[model samples]
Target: MRKLIAAGAAAVALAAPAGAEFASDPAQHLMRIERDALETVSRDRLQRLMRAAAEADEDVVRVSYDGDWLAGQAAPDGGAEWKCLSEALYFEARGESVRGQFAVAEVILNRVESSVFPDTVCGVIEQGTGELYQCQFTYTCDGAAETIHEPEAWAQVGKVARAMIDGAPRALTDGATHYHTKHVSPRWAGVYPRTATIGVHHFYRKPVRVSSN
Candidate 1:
């Protein structure tokens, strides 16, 4: 703190014009210098505080289902993990509502957290590749080219994926790691405990197996 005050005092002294005078009296000159130094110190402290706040805010991804909030966010692009998540949302849940899209993203992230699924976003999404009807996500095994034809929808879902990847709360899905569209009742859906029904998808979490002695 003393160093900071000394630095502040030096800065204020150096910032003054070449011919500027604080006061004729030595006492008053010292008083003016001290006041200016204190003000500079306060401003410097405030700037540091503001920068810390901004950095903390950047770490938190506010969970909001509002379309306006998502649309207002800048276009997001990231590494392979982010791209895989964005593509998953684009192909699997682009048509879903903003809340639904977030829900789907939550499921993917929840899978990453689960011991049963792969730990990474890309790994989780591509768990079963190159095998028709054997992949976890149908789009990967469907054999059809994963072409992104709709830029607007892609952008929207990309925002959702980015938020989820940035640690948005997965409250909508209740820690669900599996989801299937309502039109199809997969064999696993019958056994997994249904946690959430959002938009056209049914979200589920695998039941915990109790080990008996």
Candidate 2:
């Protein structure tokens, strides 16, 4: 805090005019100028801080079903893990509602937190990749190209993935570590307890920890 204040003060002082009046009361004149500089910097800094707070408050909002909130965010530029999460959302749940997309992110993240799954998003999502039809996520080994054709949709889910990675709440999934689309009923779904039903997917978390391969 002190560093910020000092930097703000220095910036205000440096930006001020170099010329000074030759006053008879030189000491008082210098003191007054310093006081004015301090006041100006403090006021400007406070206003900037307040505006930043307001903007940040607006940036993160409820993930709406219509995807209205996504327009406010850019596609996240992150590492491989981020890309993996975004891709999973793109192939698996991009057409889902915004809430549904976030719910999927939540399930992936929840699995990361579980002892039964890999400790990272990519590790969990791409598990069982070498064995066809054995992958945790179908997109990884379904023999189809993992190409992303929808740039806008990718950007939206990228924002969702980044938000989830940055500690966004997982309220929708209810601690689910597994989910499958409504079209297919995997045998595992019957074994695991249902936690949520978001959009076209049914979510579940295993009743007990299972060994991760």
Q: Give the best candidate by TM-score.
A: 1
Runs of candidate 1 with Cα error greater than 4 angstroms are 1-58
Residue 161 displacement (Å), model 2: 0.5
Q: How would you encode candidate 2's per-residue C-alpha lDDT over 135-179 as one tens digit per residue?
A: 989989989989989998889899998887766767887888889
Poorest 10 consecutive residues by lDDT, candidate 1: 22-31
Score every model by TM-score.
0.72, 0.68
67 Cα displacement, candidate 2 (Å)? 1.5
Residues 1-213, candidate 1: write the lDDT tens digits: 757765655665666666657422334455576789999999999999999999999888787698999978889989999999999999999989999999999888888988888999999999989899799888999999999999999999888888888788888989898899888988999899999999999999988778897
TM-score, prediction 2: 0.68
Poorest stretch of ten by lDDT in candidate 2: 20-29
Every model: Cα RMSD to truth: 8.3, 10.6
Candidate 2 lDDT (Cα, whole model)?
Answer: 0.83
